[model samples]
Target: MGEKQPNERLTSWFVRSGWSKGELARQVNRRARQTGAHHVSTDTSRVRRWLDGEQPREPIPKILSELFSERFGSVVTVEDLGLRAVVPVTGAGEVDLPWSGAQTVQLISEYSRSDLMLNRRGFLGTSLALTAGSALIEPMQRWLAPGPSGTPTPILTAANGGEPHTGRLSGPELALLEQTTVMFRQWDAHNGGGLRRKAVVGQLHEVTDLLQETYPQETTRRLFRLTAELAHLAGWMSYDVGMHPSAQKYYVLALHAAKEAGDRPFGALILSDMSRQMIHLNRGEDALELIHLAQYGSRDTASPRTAALLYSMEARAYANLGEVNKCHRAARLAEDTFSDVRTGETEPDWITFFSEAELNAENAHSYRDLAYHSSRSPLYASMAAPVMERAVDLFRVDETHRRSYAFNLIGMASVHLLQEEPEAAAGLAHQAVDIAGKVRSERLNTRIRKTTDAALRRYPSVAEVQHLSDRITTALPEYAAAG
Candidate 1:
């Protein structure tokens, strides 16, 4: 693209708005007052320089853009003014998020606005790097210590027609938010990001807006928790369709909201979700670091089921590194912990997704990863096959859990291929693709791709195997295009 010239657009806009330099300055002051800025200037001289192609500084361009937009009765942006926005620099080592309630909310609000922008430049890709590494050390340490006393609390309350109101979020309102979370989660599991991304982002916007209202302290905390879960779900939905960096940002948003709410467990869950993103992107060491961070964040308070889930994540990371012994150790720890899982213990709604069956499927894949390191040791593949078989047996016949069922079959097919059992592998691959057709998960598509690769490698000459491979290869473009 050609570089756009400055002042040309701005001058044209001024002409279109038919405003004199003094009028433009007055407009800036008017906008500043509307937004409650006390330090804004009414400088006709500055306005003249802008019209003559001298670029204005930070926030002035933003304010000016809005003023012209209002006057012209159309959308206008700082970019339309041909001025560069002095965006805050976000680097890998910076923890940019502040450890204050209002600050966290402000961060989320700004992020949501940017994310919803169709032409948003920074979020074009997704991330797994926590970005807050060196920057977050102080905040993490503070979170570990008791929350400071006398911190200003943000009020949460009710609103109608998007206007402020004087009341706390009622029990029914809280229940409604909870139900919304549940419904979106169910749909996300089945159809994945392709179908649910926009809906999830809308949920984030609604919750974020509601969070700006006034409520009692307890209700405020609950609202924070609910918003945190919604942000986490938005992150996962983004990850499912391959919006990696944006996914990481939403995960961080959830982490901040959870921490702000004093919910350490959910914070830990957000870290694990980020770890999952890293592992899928093939950053094994980074994934392991995130999992360890999760464990540390949760510590002794985590339920056995949650701990097992964390350990399973660790196994997946170690498997990504092709570290067989470490993978088995974590896998064994995960399995052993789940053995003591009680039926009636309180658990987060998200934990409902994991159990013995999920653990088995996770372990089976870990072994398959090990098998990849040493094709000579078909024993790894042999071990994976039966575990996957049991996982498939344990899976319920529900389309909502379709990804789970399809992935277990895909894992089984991989093991069979490793064992040089072409016919069985082909049959299973075909079965997985059929199930995948019912879902919108790129992660599932990834497993299907794995199945296709195994089939081609083990029995490229077989008609059934070739047909399945061709089918998978053909469908992936459509999934990518779905983005």
Candidate 2:
């Protein structure tokens, strides 16, 4: 609004890197595309604007820090470049956790409150960069350490000087809360997170408040596990709507809650979820590290289905890295382990969702990535097609999972596209578009647009491709407008 000042800190770093303004812009754009942020298109003009002390939105500053760090062969941060003003943490919740049992209560309370306020203000954790994949290693090591048993701590009140045990709930109340959690999970699976992420955040806020009251040891453990599940749900919802930094923070809180509850298997699952996000962002090496950590940590405790899920994620990471043989090996391990699962074996509800449908979906995803990475695209695409078809068939029968059904259709279209079947690809893409209208998911919308765009690019002269492009333009008007 006023006369702007030059960003001397950024300029100094830019000069030290010895890259021209155009080069910097080009590199930043390349990195953004590599992460699947397809809408980002940094030009020299934008770089010049940044030099004039204008802040770029969301992930640009984060990308610049990583690029600078690489060029200098040392760590460079947003703070060192005076971009901290743009990347605000907004609350005390982000302070590195001490991992003590009581800190879980404090962290959830503070973090959820901040999250709700941000939602009210129409801001959804857009100021922070995604945490580096390697950055999580030390924190994970701390998670594996045998620490305190996570007993509850008292919260002092000024009004009641001696009273410390007033905040307890009856068993029915806890049961109702757990039931609400399951309902939320089902709702998310069907409709995506855009519709109810705020509701989940509010519930998490209430749960953290309940944790402040002292309870018996067993009750405390149950409350903490609920906290973990809610936090994980909150994170998943945020990711569904593309609020990535917020999702990452929520996931960290969830992992902390799981640790306090002494739920090691669920903790491993949280790590796997984080790895999935990393893979979505195209950080394959970082994703590989996280999946490995999950597998190692859950070795003695994980159920067969959980192990199968972890192996599938490992295959995805390897596929992303173009390691076809390793991907196959992990995929086979996942299949073998899953085939051995006996009926009626006790398993957690969180894991029961990873049935044949989800497994095939994951397998299809791995081969799709391999198709993208391989020089022999048709070879891998052929492998992906039938698996993806089965995944789509399985998903279609489950009414609670329409969003996943739409996602698999897009994958099937991708496989067809790679095999030079534009007409078939267009048909599947049309079904995905129809489902996208019913699903309120930012990620799904983006994927549909991306897949359709690819189809248009590949077969621009084909009538079916033209029709698909026209359909997408009508259905996803915002993407059309952006173009």
Candidate 3:
């Protein structure tokens, strides 16, 4: 095909297919309505603009492509809609559009309007391909390498004549960011963070680059803090994926960014997350140190609810260290702090979801933890069930928190098994395993495996427990390997 003007190409395609501009516009509008989108006017002038190489925003182009595909009984792409120059063909013979700043903003806005309507659901195709590429151990190894000796590259200054820099993000943009964060968090919680870690990490890299290159210093600082939060999330995903060292590096980087942002509250939250990771690694001493750091760092600045959360974390550390008295003291402090928490107070965005019941649930966990470490077998059996039940009730609204609830149930089951209540323990263990099957959480699955393995070992004659254990083993190969 000879090089031709975009308008000429569009018009030629329409002519050869015997479609008038008006008809195409009508078809596009009809499809948009079907998707519950605002119907664009199918006037002659609008159609003329499309034939004149004007690329209508998002859904319009997508709708046109779909309509054309249906009309011609062949694949129609953005290129065939007079945008071949803007969107080039990939090596895989698919039309690939560059997701630049403007495009990202637009896509995000569209997704906010109706995520269900977006053609590329779950993960973007490009993101999926990049994740597959990064699955090779070497690439991840490189990302985990130490920083270079030379000074880091300076961030690029925004262009003088470029778009006006807004000191603060618009409400819509902020909402979009928050929504995206929640969606990814839920996905991470239910599923092993492995599946979407690379994609979210890539997004953090992109957003960080854009913010640094385009924003003013003050805006850049705030943006960097948000970027750091995303980085922390990426690290959490890495930790969930068994890439502990890589996760540590990301956490360190996030800590540096948070400190630079002068956001003590956020820094404390990151520290709390770091402590949790340490606990997972069985570094109880290290976890305790980090939890103390978090409590101290946010002592003056944190809200009552946040303070309660920090204290709860400290209690967990104390429990892990087998300090029952200290654990009880911290748990009481958490409860007292939570009692003073007021509704509608300007709390940090991170802990806004915590309520009185949630605090009680934390106390429950503290009791359960204390029971676990104390080897008070009957106490463990008694407290574990009620605490886990309360936690599961509170977390029912959040799919991501469901795994934690499930893990707690598994713990309760183990406690029952220790008391020689094999029948009761087997029933609870089976329930935990069943819930674990629906979620993508490796952590929850691992917890189930451990509890069920113990139960099966102790009560070899329990057929139901044996079958549940076998099913869990088959569903999660990693759990079997780790076992």
Candidate 4:
């Protein structure tokens, strides 16, 4: 037998984690049970053995990776823990999601199935690296490529080899699906993604299954569009809760569905959404490419509102990269395009949500980013709060936009901090916390902590700051525990 050697990599991470061996085992066991894995029997001895150079098993490596990732507030992987790579159990990790044609059905089915498994089991963490913008070129080219017939793919007829199945979709059934999507979007906007991501994924699965059955050309296009919307929702929800890898997968699936439906405008929206995720992950360059792709691809088909939203996202990406001039330029374009919104124009249901208020909120975020990253901190910071205030006021008028309202409150509070008004910031942060209790979003919770920490750093002696800090701990105990 080979001489036993210590697992230096695992040992280093374990020591850095500052957790007792038993605590590590307990957390892993607790997470396993929480995910319905009652059979896992990890204990301190097993952890000790792993440190002493044993590769414990299949799931321990995965579980440990997740636990450490959560503990450290960043991505940790099995390879980083020096564990042997095992074959993916469900092949979900190995599945190739091609971005074209009838093959899109297979892509949707497989990806949605994998997503459901993760939602149900919570057994695995996202190990897949996000697809970079440069890597998107081939797929983007394929998407923009015109068909040989210069038309949409002809929907398959039963005689022409549509799958013979019982779950055929009717017009009413399709309409119901659309209505359900609207309801889901409202719910997502009001609360957050963590609460109902599974439901969205489940609906995507059902939609994918229905796609396997026969339908007319119009029905097929509608089904594909619905699939795209649902997948995009699922993606956005995943992103909301900090599931970047899963979010990336869902977003790509949405893009594929959009292309399959021959819906360029929707595809642009999906691309824009993906760029937002990349921005959140601090990949601003990649985000810029994505926003540009969305802009160029949908230039003709996108309405004024959609164009404005895309430009707003571009400004956000530029702000993330500290490009103050580019950010302002894009923001102005967004504003100008927004001004062109005339009454009674036909707009997508999704795009209709990006009203003036939403545009203001987004631009505020861009300025906030610039304030953090540029020399004109006072200039950008001063602009952020008022725009955010306008957004918050508008958002408050709609009960469905509580999440947006809460987020804007945080943004305004952050600007207040930059303005040296700790008391005002504390008050706004307190309102955000109150809203946080009503909404269930991890992203919102994280923002509360960050803003809270900033206030504490600046005005720890202030009564309101001290009180707000205490209130945040009570309102967001899960985050407090993680911290």
Candidate 5:
């Protein structure tokens, strides 16, 4: 029964080309139509059956062959694609996780490809249990080692000598990618993950193509850094959309790519990001461990801004863990580091986004969390309320940051609810959800839910609170996942 089994080769190729089962079917059907033959009405089920070892009838195979060949930049025979009858099983997926540089490269490629088809049911979500702590332990160890310098093996040149191949991405294209990353960050801040998820993922797919082709060593290193950065962005976008398991996978891929690029700093940032994801998932211990990993990895030469960001994340973890004193100490350290910053310093471009506004917004969230969960002091919310107001004021003129404004408004509204001021809370909730339409984010949706729940619980009989909740339900159906 196992002789002719599910073909791993075929599945990998299809995923590498970024085709969903449905997409592959659609492409084949479209190709058949272009051939002027009787239109083949193929469904994703047919494609799934094919993946499960059912050979297609006649010209369908030819059509698929051409489609994959064109997209993958090579000749893809039906046999090569593992579509023929009695094709051997190439083992069940990539069963082993990677460790070395070569293995890491292979791992990232597999990961991006799997992303198109990874079963959502298998993701860890809010739990740290899937691979347990083992999944992260090895990578963290490698990240702590001094960043690798030049390899001893002669830096291999492309076939046509040291020049960039005509088919490869030019310097301008790479520069444009950096520019696009900036735009993506801004878009994510204002609009949310759903808006740019596909765009960043698409860029990542194209970059995989670039990485596959031969390029200069210097170019390759820079390209790896870019790939790492983009992958982190893609991961962040995924996390923003509530795809936590998938987000963790992408972050791991980004961390590996950064290490390969000799970019220890970006690796630290990605680790810190993973920690934040853990905290969001309510896995506080995991968050603290990951933050300490970041600090350990970057301690040798972390810039003030990077240090500040790291410390801020540490504060977040401590607050989540209900360690009020640890949280306060970390937050104060972050503030002190920020205060010491001056001009003429070379900082990672990504950290510049973490200004006083960003820190205050983060601190506001920490204070709010501490108030609600651990300290249970009305004082925490009172402190958080003004800081959140300050964040709103900062984000107001920066139209590209309306989502941040929305977040701060949500926090501020919660603070008012804590103070038993229902009208003030309802008014802010109304304003926050008004902008929620423009920012299609699951995180923001969670905030909406939180706001509604808090408002209702604080003053259940109040008409304005009821009306605001109804408006939220009506306006942002998709974020709410309402049919």
Candidate 6:
């Protein structure tokens, strides 16, 4: 008992590294064999002893040191392993600076991993406090203010009145805009929408500055439209990042820009997005109102697909409100409008993804909503499976959408739990949680928590279910307080 052992330190390190005890043991055994320690085996007791700060015999200790060094790319010795200590270093001097393209990629990869950890549920108890209304006020005010050339004018004309501008932007500028959109969209799908908010918002600010500084009236107007779209996306990212108020502000500013541009269809899209966010926040009534407003606003100008999307969104809101009849009517209307969408039809840019299959998925969601409010949810639960399965399949092609697909699985699991299928529900719930761990999305975590909570209530006798519930409870904020 010369020096007390630090058993907890080893456990903490293993957890931080995302490794299980078995995994650590396997690595140790592999390293031991490589180091010619034929007698050394990472059995359960030996692993436990090491976790308890008991250094292994000579050769095994060296092997452990080499293993950790290779794994983390840092020097580790028997003393470091036994003491379970880390010497903190300061600033840029502590870490290697990546230089080459490959090194840069590796650095970015590491940063992405750290960012995911930051976004994880219950990883740290700290919360990110951000408000869109406050953060965006200055920028919105600046945009609204009269410039040197007077009030910034819109380029595109209303579908019903005045001539619409068909002027094409410079090739380079348009390409850059498109490229930025693609990159952000890709990042949004792969890393969860929240992770890219800062970068996207920064890009939007830069685009806005560039337009204000250099572009003529007409060009600036078009550029403003692009900026507005980016702003809406940025707001969406904010919402995903748990900054709901900030998201609302971005939506409002985006709506304003769309109106100023006279882009009725685009404006409707922004409103629909706002409604979607409201729904997530449990403001179903507000969401319904916004969706209705979007519908009315786009009626004169929206393409068939755009109209269908608005109708689909309205259906979603109605479903959330437990308005079965209205949800059905809206879903049908969406399908009907979608049927009229023809090949080669010049659809609004925003509604390009609203295909027939996607419309069916919306219908399925509407039914699922009906199930949520009805006592016999199991009857309708099966209907959601095929539709959501298709949606998940489509979503898996892009990494950014994996979290979304995982969320959908959580929703589907809720349906299973409603149907009294605890096993299937647990399986899906576990998958959702695992995927949630990989992304930096508060929204996905929220969804997982909701699903887990519901499952616990439905199947209280299941140990795994209870464990999952406990995990979520420990990870999230104080539920009652947050509510």
Q: Estimate each model's TM-score.
A: 0.73, 0.78, 0.61, 0.80, 0.73, 0.62
| Tens-digit per-residue lDDT, 220-305, candidate 3 | 55565666677677767756644444455456556555654556677777777767766665666767877777777677888888
Top lDDT prediction, candidate number: 2
- For candidate 3, the per-residue lDDT at 271 reads 74
Worst 10 residues of 2 by lDDT: 151-160
User: What lDDT is reached at residue 457 by model 2?
Assistant: 88
What's the count of clashing pairs in each model shown?
A: 10, 0, 3, 0, 0, 6
Per-residue lDDT for 1-483 in model 2, tens only?
Answer: 799888765877788678999999999999888767778898888988888888888578777876875676433445445564242323333424677666777888887897777445323465455675445555655677766464232322211245455655999999999999999999899987766787899999999888877766677778889999999999998888666777888888898888878788999889899889889878898789888988988899998899999999999999989999999999999999899788999877788789898899999889989999999888889888889999999999999898999999998998988899989989998998888777667678768767887988889999999998887654653321121
RMSD of each: 12.9, 10.8, 18.5, 7.7, 12.7, 14.9
Name the TM-score of candidate 4: 0.80
Worst 10 residues of 4 by lDDT: 87-96
Model 1 bad stretches (over 4 Å): 1-90, 93-95, 119-146, 149-168, 396-398, 476-483
Q: What is the lDDT ranking, best to worst?
A: 2, 4, 1, 5, 6, 3
Cα lDDT of candidate 1 equals 0.72
lDDT of 4 by residue, 165-209 (tens): 454567887899999999999899887776677888899999988
Model 3, position 313, has a per-residue lDDT of 82
Residue range with the least summed lDDT across 10 consecutive positions in model 3: 125-134
lDDT of candidates 1 onward, in order: 0.72, 0.79, 0.59, 0.79, 0.71, 0.61
lDDT of 3: 0.59
Residues 249-340 of candidate 5: C-alpha lDDT, one tens digit per residue: 67877887787777777888999998888787677887898889889888887788888889999998998988888998998999899888
Model 6, span 1-483: residue lDDT tens: 587565543454455556667777788787667657677678777777778767556556545555554454333333334342221212222122322222322333333233235433211101222222223223323322333355333322221235443344576877688578767876776667645665776576556544433334456556657766776787677667555544665666566556455577887888888778767756677678777777776788888898998999998898898887888789889878888888997754446656654676676777777788777677667766677667656655644457667766777677677678877888878778777666667677767766776887778999878877766544432221121
After TM-score superposition, the amount by which residue 439's alpha carbon in candidate 6 deviates from its true location, in angstroms, is 2.2
The list of candidate 5 runs beyond 4 A from truth reads 1-96, 116-138, 146-167, 343-346, 478-483
RMSD of 2: 10.8
Task: State, as a TM-score between 0 and 1, how close model 3 is to the true structure.
Answer: 0.61
Candidate 5 residue pairs in clash (backbone atoms < 3 Å): none
Query: If ranked by TM-score, best first, what sequence of candidates would result?
Result: 4, 2, 1, 5, 6, 3
